[model samples]
Target: MTGKIRVVVAKPGLDGHDRGAKVIARALRDAGMEVIYTGLHQTAEQIVETAIQEDADVVGLSVLSGAHMTLVPKVARLLREQGVEDVLVLAGGTIPEEDHEELKREGVLAVFTPGATTTDIVAFIKSSVAGAAA
Candidate 1:
């Protein structure tokens, strides 16, 4: 808790809907984390680069395109490729329940589907990052 929890909220792939991503970004900022939002249509590489440039503690990806499987793992791989193993990778939006375990296996810390509240996301990131730092 010594420093602000920095997080990058991004929309990856061809997904154009950004209301959710923006909402989460604002919520994280209001919760005291430094939130950087990489706007719409970002590639996995771009998200990772922004995360690195921002020195983020977490990367929050919002994908409504049902391409979570493809995009999440790609971002995770890019993070690992960049030697950013400590950054928590989380995804939300229209994800099926069955894919949650698979995403976790691919190194995503948590997956948030629809109906997940802003408080839940914020708390999850805060506690998860704090625990990691501990």
Candidate 2:
């Protein structure tokens, strides 16, 4: 809580679409959070390891491969298995409204679907982290 909110922006599974991830990473950085982007095609294991190594407060995942149901929860489970209970997991890209509640139940703090603004995302991260610290 004393330092910048560190975030790991990752793309897991076979998804090659990275524009969204990059945009979010840049926005977070611009908003003063230290963001570590794990490039394209990362694995759940790699993401968790990165989060641990980076001492991240948040793990922001971007998936356009329609594997959100599979990959998102896998990352969440991996984080939990690694004893990362305090880290907030957020997802973006093509996720359906029907799956939102289920994803939250899986430990994802929030899901940003298509058309979610970068400004809103930044505000959410700031307010969410600050509120958690409170």
State the number of backbone clashes in model 1: 0
lDDT string, candidate 1, 41-89, tens digits: 9999999999999999999999999899999999999999989999999
- Segments in model 2 whose C-alpha atoms lie over 4 Å from true places: none
| True lDDT of residue 121, candidate 2 | 97
Q: What TM-score, computed on C-alpha atoms, does each candidate reach?
A: 0.97, 0.97
lDDT of 1 at 115: 86
lDDT of 2 by residue, 1-134 (tens): 69899999999999999999999999999999999999988889999999999999899999988899999999999999999888889999998899999999999999999999999999999988888788
lDDT of predicted model 1: 0.93
